[model samples]
Target: MSNPKIFVARLLGLDVFDPLGDRLGRLRDVVVVDRGLHQPPIATGLVIEVPGKKRVFVPMTRVTSMDSGQILTTGLINLRRFSRRGAEQTVAGDLFDRRMVLVDEEGRLEHEHESVLEDLAIERQRNGDWIVTEVYVREVTGRGAFGRARGQHRLVDWDRSRWARGTEPQGATSFVAAHEDLKPADLADMLHDMTDKRRVEVANELQDERLADVLQELPDDDQVQILSHLDIERAADVLEEMDPDDAADLLGELPDNQQELLLELMEPEDAEDVRRLLEYEEDTAGSVMTPVPVIMAPEATVAEAMATIRQTEISPARASLVIVARPPLETPTGRYLGVVHFQKLLRYPPPEPLGNLLDKDLEPVSDLAPVTHVTRELATYNLTCIPVVNEQQRVVGAVTVDDVLDHILPEDWRAMDPDQTPAPSTENPAPTAGGPASARGGAPAAPAAGPTTNRRT
Candidate 1:
């Protein structure tokens, strides 16, 4: 077998196959046994997420070929579930994203400067032991994009890095980068599977806007947990970035004092919107409606309304209808005139006024109306969103179908499905042909004669 040095990050999610070409599972993580201070940890095995999402361990020796998208393993396999043991850590779950100190070649600390672990390169030695050899890291230079630090990214010898003191919190710079392409909901699901400590660490590292988006998709309990762990000032900042209605919902779960403190710390404009929603009873139109819906004046052109809806920041539900109201286009406008469906705008000329296309027959719902009433109105009109009005008949906001569904669903609807597999065993089981014993107890057997090649992948 060739000895290619591969970054652990690149190995994650790669398909794992047996010698007979039978699909087995996907590579989830690399398990390594720490070899103390300056020595690279020996790569002991691979954590494979098999069918049913059950993660099992495949000792390194069992791996026959590892390339770009997949790994070929010898047929000899252990079906027992994989669990962490003394001195053993999984690269993806435990090491990547950790804060570490940079050290010089002489092992002298580099002014205590900090860096985050982004990836680890591992290679099989002549003796057939696979070990971590290089560390890819990003320097921590304070907050930058999305509140995460930005600085030089470098790959250094494994021995040049030292784990930060245990007292310090771990960093999530690399973790967030690795998953940056994931959708907010998918990211939320990923966060749900992590330990609370790691979840909070990642949340704190995320930018306010990004974290706010993720919070909106997470379960209410998760939202509160992540928020409670953030700094008060940052918590307020993140809340401001969230949709007003969602922010209010999250704040409602906190103690009055804590909620009030965060709200007070928020920008006045943002806080005012959230405070308005907080005043309404839960399950009411006003409580779930977004105050910052797309609103336009009676004289606004169809083209203008179309342009407004095209904005990327506006959600589909909010863009489905253009609220044509009296002067003062902002929420709580002069009066609730009517709404123009997006389809209607498409039929009219760009120069045509939105006022002429208003669906005057559609009655608006009162802010105080129950969610059931709002739902009936939306269903009867076949509308994605309906105008919400105050006692004075002024448009205050709009209740979207999504908001209705959120309220109607079970309280635990946002919770992730629990894994059906039993908890992984904590005890280290006996070693098999290519198990931990090679790294922990004694030298691994000699590798099968083959051309030796070492290249970073």
Candidate 2:
């Protein structure tokens, strides 16, 4: 049967399965090799985000089926993480919405006009190799505010489109739009896989709040790299958007001078909070604890506490427990009354005073306590979070289970694959049915049909 042409956009997010019907991951991007100025790029592989949020490359040769909603491949799969190389680019990440000149069949630029590359269409040849054969583009009609442009859209053969050369600043509007729904952690994983240039471009394009959330999920090096690339003022703004403890942690990675400059640029209140956290030694309850936990006064009602935790900005760990203090409910709050677990709030009447239901017997940890002490206290009491009190008996902050785990885990835990079993090296000999390809490179073959339902091997 003749192979059908597929638009690359439709393939994104499709579930990928092995020959035995076991799901391996979802398709995230198409890897293509550049084939000179006027030739169609060859589709080499698919970037699949597998279990544990790790992305791996699957050579096109191993793909057996490409049905709606899912893709099927030969059982042989490499468990190694995907890393892009020179001469290769991702269709969605690198090309989509890129500016290119419209050319005629003779390869001459048409009327000095430019168009935005919106999408690419890839077709499988009779011999099974897949190539990007067509491009959908939108002519740049005019420019508007914020670099936005008005355009008329059309489709053209790939050979008639010439990618504009030179270091024109590429906007990440389309790229961010493609993955806008991704969680911060998943988006961080995708960013971790991108080339440094592309990663910085996308980071700069993201809103401060969104970027802050993603920064917290990234490894320390990545966080520093991205922040260092930004303008000092903007970097400070992003830091202000992050949780006080996270901002302090990231700032701690920089030189003292740079840290002071960024802090100086931040709003006074935000800077103060981060400065307080920075005063503590690393891995201590004071350093890792979030100073913005849901705190209310003793006179606050159960309903008020519930409403406070219900805010979208409050994290689950912070919301799990409400600290009831005296006047000045903020961190460094007035006399630490006690904490009321979320469960207790649910049990009591809406108007019940938080002071009457406080868990007084549950002691707060000292800010100077080591992480080991905090971890043990949390584990012993089966608590999601515990308040950290200063020498004055004021609620200074709260350390949650996540904070403890983050401190206790290996420093490189974010980059480590969750499945610790060693995977067969990609340099190994090919197997009879399906086999691993050379690291960073592979060839294509014809496609075949396979089963769809997921099952264990």
Candidate 3:
């Protein structure tokens, strides 16, 4: 039989019908299983979103014919909720519009080129089953001024790009490889133009830490939309991966019911930190500071401090400095001794205690410090993060410049396409606390303004 191609995008939300031509529901997602690398993943079934019922699964084995955006099936639509099993990948849910590299007829990757999937071409097999045959792609050239006009776009069968499924490298072989090398911020930027449904689909495919990083870079609306789509369990996991302040801010956007549910699902300690941040009124340092940080005790050696940072998976911004405190060390949190900027520690030998290297002059901010004051302090000191202390001068959390920008920028600033990389630390989860604080350079600034506290040394 001659191959008749159907784009997966055209099939999504199209009417699905029974053999008798009676309407059943709309095609919500296409399910497939990975057959290993460089092979086309097999179409196992279709998920139909019936109006009054949960999405139902119809096995492709029983699919009779597909034509003109309609799916005619001989199978009984299983009334039970459609559940994705292990090794199964969905087309609309997983691979639609994902970025992939196009290879030539000889299987060599194109030079300095990439394409966003426009659609998938499905063809019928001899066994009367359907499988993906070709990929429809649109090559995007350079953007025009004001980011308005991008160059000429044409759709083509870029290559015989077959789908290869695996958890570590899921979807097409090219995308699997390319996406692995992309930082979370880059990935977030790529998803900016995608529809919320498509964005959520991609979100579901990302690991918790990666999703958390991407969420931080997305607009608040998109953040809430994507998180709302995630199951409470997964949402909680992503929240745990996020900085406590960001997570708290996001949770504030959700309905109280959902917010509370996700909080309850989170680890008790992490949840409490978020809850505490939530208690602070918006625009306060306490409201924007991350309650969890790479904190060290006064007596910890440079070696021990670096060891603690290395052992913990913190993002670069969080790792920029290791806050040293008295007892009750927790972030957004304990007796504020002082801070040891990562750069200051690198200047000292390993056995030198952090207490000796502490930047004692870096006065801590009150929890209620005004946003303007927080901004000025950071800008004045060329700092990315500063400690937020309670009335007792105990360290509670640290306010990051990024969080400060999130609040002070215009409400719609989130809509801005990141022309540059999102922040100093693009690594997921949290950046490792190893590099010099100045390694991720910021704009040179004026002298520090706050009162220099007395140094014990």
User: Top model by TM-score, which number?
Assistant: 2
Kindly report which residue pairs in candidate 2 clash with one another.
Answer: 128-446
Using TM-score as the measure, what is the rank order of every candidate, best first?
2, 1, 3
Tens-place lDDT digits, model 3, residues 1-457? 2234555665666688887879988888878776654677777888888876557778877676665557787747666546554466677667765666666677766544555555665666677666766666545465457643243334445244533223243332334234756777777776777877678767766656767888988878889899988887778878987878889889999999989999998889889988999998777778888887778887889998777667556657777888888766765345677889988778899999888887878887778765666777788899988877777777778877887787666665556664734443221122234522222221000111211112111
Which lDDT tens digits does candidate 1 get at residues 1-457? 5546777776678789987899999888998877778578999999998896667889998888887767899967775445454456778887877888888888889865588787878888898888888888888877676876577787888888888887232346557756767899899988987899999888866767788899998998888999999878778878988999999999999999999999898889999999999999877778999998889998999999989999999999999988888878777887888889999899999999988888888777788776766776688778899888887888889999998877665566546255543343323232355632222111002221221112122
lDDT of 2 by residue, 1-457 (tens): 2355777776778889988889999989998977766567899999998987767889999888785568889967786556554356788887776888877778788866688776778888887788888777778888879776567777888888877885233445557756778899999998988888888988876767788999999999899999999977679878988999989999999999999999998889999999999999876779999988888888899989999999998889889999888878777888888889999888999999998999988888888766776777788899999988887888889999988777766676667787863443333222233221111011001122321112111
Identify the runs in model 1 with alpha carbons over 4 angstroms from their true place: 1-171, 416-457
TM-score of 2: 0.58
RMSD in Å for all candidates: 23.0, 20.8, 20.0
Per-model TM values vs. the true structure: 0.57, 0.58, 0.56
Give the clash total for candidate 3: 11
Overall lDDT per candidate, in order of appearance: 0.79, 0.79, 0.69
Off by over 4 Å in 2: 1-172, 421-457
Q: 1 or 3: which has the higher TM-score?
A: 1
Higher-scoring candidate on TM-score, 2 or 3:
2
